[model samples]
Target: MKRRHFIGAAVASAAALGAPMLRAQGRPRVVVVGGGAGGATVARYLAKDSAGALDVVLVEPNVVYSSCFFSNLTLADLRSPESLEHGYDRLGAFGITLVHDRATGVDRARREVTLGAGGVLAYDKLVLAPGIDFVPGSVTGWSEADDEIFPHAYRGGAQVALLRAQLGAMRPGGTFALVAPPNPYRCPPGPYERVSMVACLLSRINPTAKVLVLDPKPSFSKQALFEDGWARHYPGVVEWIGPDAGGAAVEVRPGVGEIVVAGAVLRVDVANIIPAQKAGAIADAAGLTEGGWVPVEPLALATKADPAVHVLGDAAAQGDMPKSGFSANSQAKVVANAIRAELTGSRAFPPRYANTCWSAIAPGDGVKVGATYSAGEGKIAAGAGFISQAGEAAELRAATYAESFAWYDAISEDIFG
Candidate 1:
C-alpha cells in the first residue's frame, strides 16, 4: 500500500477506536503533557503499537518544535534554524490527538489536566515530560527581560537566532563571555559545544577575538576531548575558568555589557548566560517536585507522588541518564511499554536505556560520550560507556562528525515520524 494511504487508514481506524468515540467500548485514555522528545515518543508508540486499542492525546504549546539537540550548529552557521524545526503532522497521521495549548495544571486527585484553553482532559494515565525551566534569580542581573543582551539559547527556537545574530554583530577583537550552568542541568555537554561553535565563528570573522567560559563546575562532560580540540582547532582563542579559579563567584551587568568574575570586571561583546535549571513549572504546580525535580521509579518512570502519573525526560530525576533528547526518547519507550502492559494486558519487558551526546569541537571534528543503563537499587545505574579518546586521527574525527549528522536525522525521524 502507498504510505499516504496507509497512514490515512491508520488514522481513520484510530479515531474510530479513540476514547471520545469508543468510551462506551472501554478504550483506555492516555493524556501526554508537553509534546517534546519524551512526550511525543510515548504518545506515538502507545498509539501505534497498541493498534487502535488506546486513545492517546498529546498537549504541546508550540506548533513547530525546534530541537535543542542540534541547535548549537546554528551559531556556527553549519545548519539553519529552520532545519531543526519539526511539525506534528506525521504524528497526527498516526492517530494521536495533537492539542496545541499549554497545560495550566494537573489535578492528581481527579486525574485531570487543566488546559490554558479552558478544558480539562481526564486520563487513565497521565505522562508529564515538560522539560526544564531556569531557576529564577540563579544568575544575578540576568532574566527573561535581559535575554537580548545575554541570550541563554538553551531552549532553541528564537533564542538560538538571537544568539547567532549577537555573535555576528560582535566587534572585532572583543570577548564573548559564557556563564555555564551548574551540574545536573539539561544536556551536560551543551555549553561546551556552544563555546566551540562560537570560537569557530569568531576565528573566521575575528581571529584576534577571545571566548571566555566561566563555569561553576570544576570539570565538564568530555573535558579532555573538548580541551584538546580547543587547543588544536582554535588555539589561544578559548579560555576556561573553573570554580576554584573564581568562575563560580561571578555577576553580570547586562546594562553595561560587563561581567564581574572574582572581583574583576571585564567588558564583553556578547554574553551567554545559562543559569541553573529545574523541572518545568507545571511539574511544580502538580506537586510532583520535592527538591526541584520529580523523582520517578526507574523501570516504569512512575512518579513517586502518584503511580498513575509518569514523569520522563529532564523533569524526572532518573539516575545515570543525562538530560539529553536521546535519554528522554529512551525513557519514553520504557514508559510507553509499561503503560501498555497495564492497560492492554501486553507483556512488559525489563527497562533498559541508552544515550549518546555528540559535540562538534570544530568543523569536521566531533566527539561523543554514551552509556547503557539499567534499573538498579533505588535508581537507574550506568553499565558500560565509552568516550572519544585523545589524539584520534583526523579522518576518524571527520567520520564522527558525519555520524553525528546521521544520528540527528535518524533520531528526529524516530521522534516525529
Candidate 2:
C-alpha cells in the first residue's frame, strides 16, 4: 500500500527467502536493487546480453512481484494480481544471481553492495532501482504505522488486498477517500485513476457509495477524460476535491480513521494516502541523493554522486518527468546500455527514453500517456509525448487499453519473462 511497506515486505528479507550463495563466474559483477519494474528489467537485460561477461545479482525480497501499473484494473475485475505477478526463473539461463535481500548500503569506493541479510556483495558496477519511498512525517498525525489502518495501494499487491478488504467491509453508501500527495510522486496519474477504478468497484455493489479525491494540486493528468468518464459512467458516484475546492489532506489520524483537509473534516471508510517520496534509503545511506532524489548525468543515467553507481526508476531525479514505473523502466534501458558500454569499453550510445502510463477508466476502457526522452546538460528532457483524447471512441479505447496489456507483457518479456 504505502511504498515503503512494499519495499520492507517485498524486498527486506534475504536469507529467509532462499537466495543462492553462489556467484556466477567469469563475469563482472552487476548488483541490482528492488525487483519491481526497473530493477528487474535491468537485471534481465544485463544478464541476457552480457551472459558470462557480466554476472547480474538482483537483490529483491519477493520471488513474485505484482506491478502497480495494471493493479487498478483489478478493481474492475478485469485483471488480477496474477496478471501482474512475475518471477525471474529465466534469470538463471542468463547467468543472473537472484538474491532475496534489500540493499541496506553501498560501498562506492570498494564497489560493493551491502544487503540487509546477505552481507557484502561485490559489484563492478551497481544498479540501484528500488522504487519510491514515502517522505518522513509526510502528513501530520500520520506516520508509518498508520499504514495499517489506511492502505495507499500506490505500491501494488498485498496493499491491494488490504484496501479491497476494507472496501468489502464498509457500508454500501460509505465514503472512500483518495488522498493525493504533492507533485513529483510516483505514478503522476495514479491517484485519479485509482479513485475512478475504486468508484467503478463501489458503483457495482453500492450505487450510493462515493469516491472523494482530495488533491494537493490544482491540475491532474487527463483531467478532461477522467471527468467525462466519471460524468457519463459513474454520474454522482465520484467527486474531486481540487486546490480551488480546498481538497488537500494536510493531516490524517489512523486511530480516528479521519483526514483533516484545507478546512473540512471528512471521515472515510477507506483512505488511500499517496505520500511525498524520495529515492530508496540505500541511495541516501550511500549519499547518492543530494537534493533528495539522485541527480544524474542524464546522458549516462549515471549518478554524479558516485560514478560507479547508476540510479534509475522512481529514485532518479529526472525533472519534469513524473516519478513513475514506466519512467523507471525506460530509464533502465539507458542505464543498462551505458553500463554495457562502460564495461566493454565500447562507444557509448546517446541515451533515449520511452515511457507510457496507462490507467483503467473502466473495465474495458483506459486512458494512456506516452513520451520520449533524451539527456540534456544536467537533467533528462522530454522530446515527444502524447495523451489519449477525451471521450474516446469505444473501439479505439478498447484497443488502446488492450495495447496497455501488450505493453506490460512486452516490457516484462524484455525485462524478465
By TM-score, who's the top model here? 1
> Which pairs of residues collide in candidate 2?
11-61, 313-328
In the range 259-333, model 2's lDDT, one tens digit per residue, is: 787867778888887777788788888888876689888886788877888888888886556777777777787
The digit string of per-residue lDDT tens for model 1 on 270-347 reads 999999999999999999997789999888989988999999999999888999999999999999999999999999
Query: Clashes in each model (backbone N, CA, C under 3 Å)?
Result: 0, 2
lDDT of 1 at 373: 98
Off by over 4 Å in 1: 1-25
| TM-scores for all predictions | 0.95, 0.91
Specify the highest-lDDT model's number: 1
Local distance difference test, candidate 1 = 0.89
